[model samples]
Target: MKKITCPLRWILFLFCFPVVGSYVCAQDSVSVLFIGNSYTYVNDLPGTFGALAANLGKELTIDSKTNGGYTFQNHTTDPLTYSKIHSKPWDVVVIQGQSQEPSFPDVQVNTQTLPYAMQLSDSIWANNPCSNVMYYMTWGRQNGDSQWSEINTFEKMNTRLYHAYMRMADSSDRAMVSPVGRVWSYVRANYPLINLYNADESHPSLEGTYLAACTFYTSLFRESPSGSDYHPGIGAGEAWVLQNAAAAVILDSLDHFHLHPVDEPTQASFTLVQNGDTIQLTNTSSRATTYTWDFGDGQSAITEDAQHTFGGNGIYNVQLIASSSCNTDTFSIQVTTLGVHDHLFDGIKVKTSDEFIELTSSGGTFLIRTFSIDGKLLTEQSLSNKNPLMISRINQFQVLHLTDSGGFEKVIRIF
Candidate 1:
């Protein structure tokens, strides 16, 4: 045989490798922990998670701890240890040194601090097992202070911090960096006057905080902020701005790496009462390849056809899921107990003049019956092969009795 090789072989192998790998890494939910100082706690950054959850329709648990001016040195040097984080489980831990430490004149302080932060992260993972660590790369103060002259200006100071954080995070396979600083850097380029801090240019104002909140929401929740009357995009003036640069960094970093898991299957359907107590679900979508049924009354099925007999007077949520190779649709049918003469029947016009009652099946089968006050069935007729029955003269305080060909008795009381 000739020594010929196929070019398509390598491509097929590469494509199949990831698809097989994703199945092994799919997760139901993600848990995150935020560890920072006043920058994270000042206006309760973690508190905004609820709003993010409501907006994105995602359920995630976030725990955060903050100190006013604590640095990595303070964290590793006793007094304030990782005691609170020792016992619980976490999927990801976000850590940041004191906001100013990265740009400090003494490189020794930052050099010493990075190792301690990494050590603490390792200890956290050792205790919890399956956890990843991430660093929050913060920005410099807007004011160009004399102590940071080596950084030239506030912008340069923040830039150095961003690069340094990334280098530290990239060194270890277990750690990653949230580019909150890069987001700020991009924003500062467009709006030179837009400082996230207050008049001191060191702390954030309400507008600054809102902007920061948007970045965090987008980064963690994967939802973009819709410019409302209150919050406009970055194009609007500072007063109308809602999201800050730090948040944008985090959001962009997340987007750069597609981190969303594969969607789970869902099913939806409508339920119909074929007879008084027998309920049947009809698949609305034509594409449903498989059906899963969970009838609220302890009935379940994995077949396309699902049938249930409701025994008593109560409300039940009948859930049906229809799924295909591509997607799944879920629907819930609420079967409620109804008094014979429920108001829903008020809109139905009666076609008879005597004390007549009509029984209807969801499959369009209908029967009419006339009854005496003592439950005596005077006359009965098949009104329609399949439809709701039309009865007249059904006044207040009367009982409806229906007798099927199978000798099934359905009793409905008119109030």
Candidate 2:
């Protein structure tokens, strides 16, 4: 007597599902929502990130809905997530999948992660045209994904994870990747003493969560967290280390994560001259309408050409960010300053032209050393009986160390 109908079945499904609360929109503040599973909730990433932002004097409204071991497919099918996405004018919506889902083979990723990511991104944009969808690129398991033969080693799994998240971000217009996994890779490789994983090797430890929070801070604010006062209950020393690590990997190269501010390409270039403790910055950028400069001494400027005075003598990493409506570029240089009376290398005159570094000394053998701003040595040479040694420009900017045979040394900035 009763005929089973497809429409009736769908209605029953909707009725049986649990109701998710509607997210209220906020005004005059940055608002973000996190959607994922245990990886996002274990250490309370959203809360920690909010605290970090607060410590930086920024107001961020943060929310999250996470379930244990839930995948993107689950989120796509869940009515609560759908309601949340469609209910608010969110500034950002962060999405992360099951830890193992992204490490699967390409076919599996296409069949599973890609489709769900596209759906979520579409929902985010459809609901709030100005909202940004950030895909949280999670790290591989501490040891590896043993359940799958294709992802047995950490390197293998991480490689696959990187490609998967990149693919997802590239496929959508409003999507960008957080590259939290890449940050983990950097920490593990460089800071082996810092353990990011818990005993289970999958969930993040407090330090790991702190790093993630720092990454989020940089991504959302488009500024480095190096000077933030928040430590999130961790020791100040360790917090500083984590903050710098995140900045070095994320803020230094936003393009690696496809997190540039705009879609059109732009370049950041600048030259600076130090007069005593005051430095004047000249912006030489292309295809840019806005400029932001971080003087690397807890000071920042927004003018096209800015001048800043330092209080002490030390090396500072100065960053210049140039942006257009759809794209951004970054350039950085290290500025070293000394007192007016200090002369380490007396008689060593340095001049820079468009293409070469012109150096003149008092007719003796001198050792020339060049280094990147990050303190990496790039070139080393000894000049003997040369009146004016001309070295081609190695990079946009570098530090040149000149040491005379008599043991006198001088450090100069080449721009």
lDDT of 1 by residue, 1-415 (tens): 1111212533343344321000111233666677776666544555554343444455556666665555666666643347646636766667778766666544564466667776767766666644656677776667544454556577777777865676556443325565556666676776667666665565555555556656655555455654423432234556344444444445544523222222321224442433345555555432347788887888799877676777776788778877766467677766655344333222222222123344545332224455665767755666334455655543322445554444444544332
Candidate 1 regions with alpha-carbon error over 4 angstroms: 1-29, 78-81, 192-195, 221-415
The per-residue C-alpha lDDT of model 1 at residue 404 equals 48
Best by TM-score: 2
Residue 232, candidate 2: how far off, in angstroms?
2.8
State the displacement of the C-alpha of residue 98, model 1, in Å, after optimal TM-score superposition.
0.8
**Residue-wise C-alpha lDDT for candidate 2, range 157-210, written one tens digit per residue:** 887898788778767652668888888888889888888987677778899999
Local accuracy by lDDT, each model: 0.54, 0.75
lDDT of 1: 0.54
Error of 1 at 72 (Å): 1.4
Clashes within 3 Å, all models in order: 17, 3
lDDT (Cα) of model 2: 0.75
